[model samples]
Target: MDTIAVDPDLYAAQSAYAPDDWQSETTSIRSSIYRGLMDNGRRIPSDEQQFETYEAGHLVDLILDSDRDNPLFRSPIGADRERPLQVLDIGTGKGTWAIDVADMFPNATVRGVDLFPPPVTWMPPNCVIEVDDVLQDWTWRERFDLIHMRNMIGSFDNAEWDRVYEQCFEKMAPGGWIEQLEVGPFITSDDNSLPEDSALASWGPILQKCGDRAGRPCDIVLTMPQSIKNAGFVDVHEKVYKWPIGPWPRDQKFKEAGMVNSQHWMSGMEGWCMWLLTKYGDPEPWTKDEVHVFCAKLRNELKNPHYHAYHKA
Candidate 1:
């Protein structure tokens, strides 16, 4: 089996944090301490940075806000009185959404299904994290009232998504709701602000190719709304939000989040690129030292009030 090592230059370029946040600790993705971990097999500024709600509360809130109709816990879509709803959160990364849902709807039973165990800090009275792949040929005997899937673009294909939706449709009670959220990777700004030849633009095609080579179609975001409609769903609605990648926005809150996100991006770049190269050529063409320097420059630019990048999902 081929395995990749965490690049030392990439790790060293991370933004300095408080001693408490930067404690010299090592944990695998299987561990609870590594909650909110995302591995697309790359080394970027934020590659190893755990995305717990505690560390990124505002970003989590912003993401959840878009799913107000069929929230992780609350069955606001078609709630009934005198019934305790059952909800399923697919790909429940970090269990932040699951935790919030459990707290929001005390009466509901929320189940989070992911490949790994739940983090220790993810405990909530009404929530349970089950170790399972949502794509597996499994049956729930039509048990859940609401199903929610978020951020599974890079991890699943259309066939898998269709099957999962079909399963959800069967499992959901009559008049139940299934909500899906995904970030579109191949995004281009109508404005020339995002140079057509930039990393963000190139990332989409490379990722798409990688997914294709791996036997999974990665471009799902552009087709999610259509997929939902095809999955026998009603009231299919879609909304788009621009998440700034750097502190370039006018809003103070957005700028702050973007700044942090930019640094995180800077920290994780080489890991990401190196992984891509391994899957696709010789990283010798791109020195690890050059990657570190570029990431450092990106991080500094993120602090500039004028620097801006958007996260369109």
Candidate 2:
């Protein structure tokens, strides 16, 4: 019988916080999520990573704004009790952002659409999570007050992205705002703390090449502004962030944010790269074992205290 490949990247993370047999009964959707500790895979680590909120976007928010009181979305759609607003979140991974927005404004009906349905068992009365491919024609009857997407880099080819944006333009109400955020895959160091020959340094270029071959470029953060404008959106506002990968920053806020963000990486990196590398790896498509070795090296490098690498978010 052919053996199932052990995901060494997830195994490394599991060994640290969970037993070796922790994920004995795991979910398998291209390794997109797990189901060991909670109903949804996103709730697997609540004890240490602050999983008090299921589907931990709380940690994501800490880094996004140091857990400040910034609005769930920046789109000023005038959502209130009087005028029910229509909000849409494309590529709503785990549906945390959409749920949060739904809870924030009960008057607004929030709809989250993704290619894969979340393992979410419960949802806000006003929030709806649906499985749909955005590249296809949209079935939403009502125009949206706000359309949002984030962490969607490399999810679409250039033409697909253009089509998706065009759909967003067509489906949105007049004066509706469209918001998107994408993170850079490259890790950078201001003081050369990350070595040039290290796996950390090479990861970005490696995946960039793979993503290019896959026809879904990973450098979406750099090109999105122009792309959004090209899609007929005007007056685009841009915000760039340096999200530290580990708790190495001197500042208290960044240190805390980094600590949480490290979990984000340890848990998320392999899933992010698996399909791309296995399908479009340089010189040849990589075996799962080869990707495992690469992820192991990166995990070690990421754990180093001296490296001050931050991803552009």
Candidate with top TM-score is 2
Badly placed stretches (over 4 Å) of model 2 are 1-58, 79-81
CA error at residue 279 for candidate 1, angstroms: 1.5
User: What TM-score number comes out for model 1?
Assistant: 0.69
TM per candidate: 0.69, 0.81
For residues 52-95, could you state the per-residue lDDT of candidate 2 as single tens digits?
32243344453457344544666666545678899999988678
Q: How many backbone overlaps does candidate 2 show? A: 0
Q: Mind giving the per-residue lDDT tens digits that candidate 1 earns over 35-99?
A: 32333211122333444322343243343343354323233543453478788888886666676
Candidate 1, run of 10 with poorest lDDT: 25-34
